[model samples]
Every structure is written in structure tokens, then in C-alpha cells.
Target: MVQRRYSGRMDERFEIFLACAPGLETTLVGEAKAAGFGPLRPDAGGVAFDGGWPDVWRANLVLRGAARVLARIGGFPAVHLAQLDKRARKFPWGEVLRPDQGVRVEAISRKSRIYHGGAARERVERAISETLGAPVSDDGVRLLVRIEENLVSFSVDTSGEPLHRRGHKEEVGKAPMRETLAAMFLRECGYTGEEPVIDPMCGSGTFVLEAAEIAMGLLPGRTRRFDFERLASFDAAAWEAMKRGAARRETGLLFRGYDRDAGAVRMAGANAQRAGVDGTAVFACQPVSALERPEGEPGLVIVNPPWGARIGKPGPLHALHRSLGDVLKERFRGWRVGLVTPEAGLARATGLPFLPPGPPVAHGSLKIRLYRTNPL
Candidate 1:
């Protein structure tokens, strides 16, 4: 059975999936709730909510922890390739895709009768191409097909580029932390934008810049284009009005980032300027040993130091972590701390009074955990 609900306006209600790193689903759900998006349900890799196209647009524009937004168009049971072809051709592709535009089909199969992903993709591709008269290209809107228990569901990736791009920060350091992960980690540390943030190892200034933007109430996708704009249901005028209506807040607190490499310091500064947050984000070249507590109400210190796998041998990294622990204990009294690392041993090596570790989050190929400390 196909379920449908019309919103009685230009926008129709549909299911939206906000994709995130695996362990961050709960945090993303909190963000969604704070953004006034619900009723929400948490899933394995993302959060699911029911909304119209406008909700989809708002989610893509404002969600800081989501990697992408997927709109679930519709689905049906199809036990075989031929049935999938028939059902896919009958789908209302014209409702979302323009005839002149191109689309790419991707398929995943799990415990299904039609278990071949390639065959499933090919059939769906042919159906859409023949029925909708649209060209299939590699760089166009992506349509994802999932087959499980003989049921096929279709979703469109409405976010063209990953939300982490944020349409700024052209220059990045080696092994830089993603903006999405950085935002979630900040949230995990109980940061609410009222307090300042410091990143002693601020690689591309992701954490500092993200914290500054949060304080300013800036939309993450304010300057970026999304794949949803290419869909047939996109309303340019409404989107423009929505963008103009964003309420930006003003803040006086400063976020700080320091790196031992002068080049990294310069890069972070430049990236902050491009992000329109240089006023609130200060970058300097210094090692953790020289880290000084900024003058303010005590705030949070968040850092994503290099794991031994990326930067150096484990022995040196342990020494570095110990040194960092010493610096924070000695200087940053009453400040909270969040440290991200791939190894628990390295985290333990820090000797900071971290509360129990959080679940590991997948970043690239490594599983990293955030170890946090209360005010010290």
C-alpha cells in the first residue's frame, strides 16, 4: 500500500531523513528539536521527520549536524527486478524531476529477493529515463533506492554538497576536523553559545568558527546552493524570502584557536574571515605548552589532536597528551574540556579527570570518542 498525505497547499507532506555520523544521531535529534523540527524519530544513521518541502528547505539551510537531507518520495513492495521496473516507472517522477535535468540512481539491497544492487539501479535508471525523458548523468541529483524484505523505497538527496562545506573555508589543514562533527562535539560538551570556546589544536579553525557562528545565529547554508533547488517543486521566491528572514544575533564573547604552525594560524585566521566570524574568532600561533586561559567567565576548551595514525608515532602522541593535560590542569581553572581522540590509551594518557567516555563516532575510517571533563 502507498501512503500519501497532502498538505493542502503547494507543499506536500513527506518523510525527511537528516543524515549524520552514526553515534551522533541522538545529538542531531536534539538539534532538530531545538530548531523546531518535529515530530522526530531517531534512527541508526539519521533522524526521520515528517514535513513538507518548506521544512526540507529549512532543514538543509539551518541544520549544523546533518551531513545531508534526504526526502523520501514514496515506496512499494517489489519482489523482483521486473516488478521493481514496473513500479518505478509508475512513480510520479515528473512531480519532482524536470524533464531537461539529469539524475543518477543508486541502489542498496539487504535481505531482499532482488539482492543485486547493480541490477536494481539499472532497472530504476531505465524506468526513469524512459518514462520521464530525463538524462541520467553522474553529476546530477542522486536518487537512492533501498530494497529490504522485498520492499523498495526511494529517496532523493536534497543536499548537493555535504553540510560540512558551509560554503566557506577554502583553505584547510591536513587531517582537519569536519564542521559537522565539530558542532556535535561542542553540543556534547554542553556548549550553548553563551560561553567562549578554545581549540588548542585548531586545525582549520572548525570548532572555533562553528562556535562563533552558533553565537551569531548564522544559518549554515546561507551562502551555499543545494540540490533541492534543481528539483521541480523548488520555489525560488519563497526560498529567497526565507533566507532574508533569518534572525542573526550579535555577540561580544570571543572564541580562540591556537596552532604551533604559523602557516596553520594564518590559514585559520583567513578561513575565519571568509566565514564572517573573524571578529569573534581569534587565531594565534602557539603550542599547547604555552596555552593560557583567556580572560572571561570560564568556557570550554575543545581540541581534535592528531591521532597517532595520522600525525606521529604513539609514543610522541602520548607525551603530547600528557603535556596538554598538564597545561589545562595548571592554567584553565574552572574551564570544561572536550578532547577527541582515536585511542582511549591516548585519552587516559592525558591524565585529565574525564568523565566516562562517550560512544565512538565514525570520522573517515577511524572511530573517535569525545572525553570530557567538568569545570576544573
Candidate 2:
């Protein structure tokens, strides 16, 4: 069901959904509350709040855990395909959509008379193009419509692309962990961007760079364009002011990533430079056997090592985990560890004392879990 708010003006306010991976709703809510955004309501796949256009802009600018922001525009009852076309054509399209900007409608149907999803999409697309004069093109804005049990609801994706892109990090390893998931794992490990961070198996430096950005106070959407800018409610001056008001600070803390692959180390370094955190986020070509504690306060050691679901056979991966576990237990005295993988036996092979595993999180096709430990 589309969540609703009763107090605000019905015409001005709408339900805003911050979509994320299913199991990470709690972590996303944590980030939202820390960023001062909401009286959040966490559901299965995301968190929701009641807001208008400015709130949407702020969410797109500040949030790090959300994949995309969806604004619930409006809806009506459509028992059949022709009724969907009729109500969609009369849906006040001009109030939010412009005549020049192109739009492409996508829809899903479940337990409804309008069982054909493609046919439903065609009806909505024709309505927007014919009624509002917005051209229907593949490269245009995406308009999502959900029809269930004869009720139709519409939403538009405010973020043009997934938030994990972060407008940087051009190169990535084969089984790269997403930046959004990385942020959540960091938060779950009680990381507040205050201490040093080390990733012994950093692929393209996603974890280290995210920590650096959090510590430096850089906004996630600072360097990217959003689909909301093309909407009719966009206020250019207000958006620019919001961006200008955010300030980035210098951090004396060091975030390090050590990879055995020299090419991966070079790629991570280049990505850090592009992200403008090269001064604080440094990369070195090394292995877990050579891992050492940094010359400062103990921080979190988060890693996304090779596992059976994504790559590598279980036998060698188990040895790698054992080696990593041995190193952390010996050299690192006060640091906590967060390991991301799908194999439970592999996490146990680490031999470090990990708390009870959390619920499984969806990463591509594999269901991965985050295994953590107290300061060792």
C-alpha cells in the first residue's frame, strides 16, 4: 500500500519512499535520522516519510544508503485497461510534468483485472504523451505505476541513477560491493567516521572512500545530476543554495586499503584522487599476511573478500579467511571486524569471535550477510 500523511495539505505533500536493500532498512533509517530528515516509517524494502518537493531535493542530496528516491504522485481506481487509460489521461499531468521533457511509463500488475503489464504501460504512456504533449522516448524520464487489486498508484523516480555511483569511481573489480551497502555495514559496526579504517581486500576502494567522504562532510549528490531537476517543481536558486550550504572539512584521520593486486591498488588510488579524498584515503599493494595496525587509534576493519557465491572455490576461500583471522587476532588488539560474504562456514573459518549474524541481505542474486565482532 502507498503510505499516506493526513496532516499536510493533500495537494502539496506526498509520500516519499527511500528505496534500499530489504534487510538494510534499519541502517538506512539510522542514516536518515542522523541527517535530520524524517519521522521515518520503515517497511520491507525502504523507509518512507511525508514531504514535498524541497524535501525530495534534500533527500537526493544528503542520503547515502538509499538507492533511489520515489515520490508518490497520485492514483485512482482502474478496474480494467480502458479505465486505466481514462483516469491516467485526466491525472493533472501538467502540474508535475512539462510538455518538452520526454517521459516513459512502466507499470506492474498483481491480482488485478489489468493483468498485462506491457499493455498497462502503453495506456499510461499514451495518456502522458497525448494529454500532456510530453514525448514518449526511451531516454526520457521514468514514470512508475503499480496496479494491485484494482487500485492504481503512480510514482516517479527522483534520482536519475542509483546512489551507489556517487559520481566517481569509474573502475571497479569483478565482484564489487555497492557503496550504499558499504555505508550500511560501516554504520552497523558502530563506525562514525571518527577513527581510522582499514580494508585489507579493497577492490576499488568503495569502503575507504565512503568513510573519507563521511568524515570530510562531503554531500553524496554534489557532483551528479538528478531527474528531479527536470520536474516542473524544481527551484534552481533554492537547490544551488542547499548545495552551497553544505561544507567539507579536512580530516587528520587516515583511511587505508591494501590489495594484493597491484593493478587494483593503482585503480583504487586513481578513484580516490577523482573523489578528492586522496590526501586522507591511501592505497597500498599488500596482502592480509602483511596487514598491520595504523599509527593511531584503533578503528574498524571492514572487508569484502572472495566467497563461494560470487567467486573462488570454497576450499581456498576458507584458507584466505583463516589467514585473515589469524592476522587480525595477532596484530590488531582493539579493532572490530566486519566481513561481508554469503558463506557462513567461511566467516566461521576466520576464527574471530563474531556476534550472531544478522538477516540476509540481497546483493545481486546472492543473499549475503554481515558478520561482525567486538574489539579483539
TM-score of each: 0.97, 0.96
The digit string of per-residue lDDT tens for model 1 on 1-376 reads: 6733333355578899999999999999999999999999999999999988999999999999999999998888888998988888888888888788899999999999999999999999999999999899998899999999988988999998899999788889888899999999999999999999999999889999999999999889999999999998899999999999998889989999999999998999999898899879999999999999878799999999889888878989999999999999999999999999989999999899999999989999999999999999
Candidate 2 residue 259 C-alpha distance from true site, Å:
0.2
Per-residue lDDT for 286-341 in model 2, tens only?
A: 98999998887899999999987667888999999999999999999999999998
Query: What are the lDDT figures for the candidates, one per model?
Result: 0.92, 0.90
Top-scoring candidate (lDDT)? 1
Error (Å) of candidate 2 at residue 242 is 0.7
Listing every candidate in turn, what is its Cα RMSD in Å to the true structure after a full C-alpha superposition?
1.5, 2.4
Judge candidate 2 at residue 87 and give its lDDT. 83
10 residues in a row with least lDDT, candidate 2 = 1-10
Model 2 residue 140 distance off true place after TM-score fit, in angstroms: 1.1
Clashing pairs in 1: 334-376
